[model samples]
Target: MTANGTGINGVNGAAPAQAHQAYQYSKEPLGNPRPIRIVVIGCGVSGIAAVKMFKDRFHNLPVELALYERNKSVGEPGSRTVTQGNPYFSRVYVGAPELYEYFKGRADAYGVPDYVRLEHKVTDVSWNEKMGQYGLKIEDLATGKTITDHAEVVINSTGILNAWKWPDIPGIHTFKGTLLHSANYDTSADLDGKVIATFITPELALDLAPKGRDTVYSREEQDKWAEDPEEFLKFRKRATHILNTGFEVIVKDSKEQKETLAMIKKQMEKRLSKKKELIPKLIPDFALGCRRFTPGDGYLEALCEDNVTVRITDIKEIVPDGVITSDGEKVELDALICATGFNTGYLGVSVAKFPNYFMTTGPAAPAAHGTFIPCIEAYIKYAFDAVERLMREGIKSICVKEEAVADFQEHKDNIVHDFVWTSTCRSWYKNGTVDGKVWGPWPGSGPHFLESLAHPRWEDYDFKYRTGNRFQYLGNGRTIRELEGGDLSWFIKKGPKHTREELTPSTVSINGL
Candidate 1:
């Protein structure tokens, strides 16, 4: 996950005119400055990306970067954390296995181990106004020691899924059965030939249930799907069709919603034809795409198994042997799995009240609508751009403007109304908000988010200069290459340049008007 090359011109090539104007306020040169201290919390994909971005962009500069992970390894104790033992989970490109490999490779290639501190959990983060920096208190989980550190910049990449909450059910402790959350679940060996009952909504139930034994793709088939462009494209097209249809059903008219449901019913009927009676109990009554769409796979088929059962009734209590439902029915079960979803209230990128303290993958992040890798890549680029500005301008602190945040929230609120996430359904996107505020899902397409992140809105930030003068960063008006006696004629070298294309309206008559 490399940056999309949007900030290269601002950093390496000529600065844009707006940037020049922003620098014009600087009064003095940034002479012999101290190394910028940056602390990144969490060693997941986003945190690793932050480390990689800082290293790639400012390796030669005076920058001290530190990364801390609470888990024993880089990725961690969550379901998405892929260790060597479990190399695969989820089919998305940014799934655990792929991300673990990608970030780990980059970390090794860039020698990031020198700055990485595994098993170090950031316990608290607070602003030290007196020191004009962020104070971080970290607990060394392995050594049982506390460490205090200060940083000019702090990045929180502890993703939303880090904190897992179990469903609130009475007498849960009394249950003698093997109970576990989906996050702790790995292989299905324990579930084999057992009476299993999962407490989950329709979306998650469909995702976890085994579709059918034959539906499992062979290694060679999966390899072919990855290797062949045409096959991949066909798969993408089908997926896109389904996603688009789901979106239409949620946002469009009742008629279209009914038609889409009928279509889905037909497909479900074909898959679970033998257990037709279970269709009404398993399928959702709400509109499609109202909540996140979980791939059904062989879920319908699994429910049809004689030993397994799908219970949509609410759980009243957990008994010694099984679960008691709202209808006073006690179902005997050897195992109880809680497949309830994660807390999504905090889903987008956010700046803590303190300046220069930023977090990623929180509410309103573009990952809600697209592949997470690209979205994380975009955020890294955006965050680094701000950091670069701070370094170049001799700025002491930079914080997001209140108006900018308010405006962004307003825009997000308005856009979700046009999407299915605004429908009357309880989901992670809604974050339990009664007002129907969508905390997840980007308002636009993936590419749109990428384009939007191409440049940071510099005006949307308030900066404090080291010298108490904003123009202090306009450093002697000399490039680093020129100052260091490097190749001065490099700009004269032949290269492809951006040329403006002029557009003219066609003069042809329209329908002989």
Candidate 2:
């Protein structure tokens, strides 16, 4: 059959007509001929991952990528605290160093090390709409030199925990004892002979008040996990299952909550049997799992020492020698430790005024539940995918629609109401907000968040392309493979076949037919 002088089927067929008349092959090279600039702030895991993704995916493309780190090293911001041998509070399922090494190794493998600028902080980010680029003011801490740089895109990987906030107790500086925040807490060696008093809220107090046992894995087991993939998968499945049980209890039903509370109480009772009087002060009156649970592991036992004391009362002020309680009772101490916590609600992403800016560990990130590495990986993928789309389309600028953000926040707010994190309890998750806003938790399963981020809706973004027309990205009626003398019928080449057969309708289930 012939239509419009083109044959539908036969050994020979006429070429298809051009779809648009305005399409002129400008005689210029196709595929982003101009260089694309990308600047990533914060050299943490998220930033490193972003850099690696961009390098791996767009190596052939003309792209310029730079990573700025405020600290002296890549993992200095958060890893400094972890390097002190204080095992991560959450169940990481893998060694902390192993994860750090993975990120660093990937960065090195992708040639990211050469592009990183250490001790260079991004003080300000301003977009020049006239030039369709972002201008950043960077300050080098070591040399004390300030410079201005421009980029087509910017990624903010500054973690939420970067900002540490101290509790506002009066006369805290008056204490003659050594004072330090938990973020700067190096070792327990100095507290060997000194009277050390660590001030913490009820949420943290519960975790530290109980003397729990640490799960120590043998070096052989670690080697086995590293060498044997199947063994590691099995171990991960079991660990995740155990962690999910707590999530279910806190977010789903109260029966499990009561049971878990009773079990914890029994354990605490047995552990502190000799000092039963401390149980009432240690066990919180609120529901269990309302806040992030830390495996105390020997913390309560340390408090039972003759020189140690777990003061339950609030601090009224800091006296010359020690802390003064709310009841005006003085507790003599040689050192004070603030286990207070970091500030939240800073979504490292772009503000309404700034467009084409993205953040990884922002307030909207899913952090309250599950391991953070996976969440960081998901967010990185989401942001980088958008960047890739921008580059492919030759888009000058793109910003997430306000409606999309609002919809996401609304969904988060609705789902968090069912979780224990929304319960009436003070914690870092809320960031001292009394409006009942839960900022930390993702309000969904880790897998759910990962899956949702896998496919970002392009419609939720407003784009500005190189050409005025949005459909200019449709490009000439030809592809790179066609221009490069590649196989035109490559799509028809078959390679491998699956063992399972495709699904077919059964003859027995033909009633509808």
Highest-TM-score candidate: 2
Instruction: Please provide, for model 1 over 376-451, each residue's C-alpha lDDT reduced to its tens digit, 9 standing for 90 to 100.
Output: 7787777677677667766666766666788998998887787667777777677644346777677776666678
lDDT of 1 at 67: 91
lDDT of 2 by residue, 404-472 (tens): 778878887888787777777776678865336777666676667677778877776666555544455
Q: Model 1, stretches more than 4 Å misplaced?
A: 1-34, 76-112, 186-189, 211-250, 254-262, 432-436, 476-479, 493-513
Backbone clashes, each candidate: 14, 2
Model 2, CA-based lDDT: 0.66
Please report, in order, the local distance difference test score of every candidate based on alpha carbons. Answer: 0.65, 0.66
Top-lDDT structure, candidate number: 2
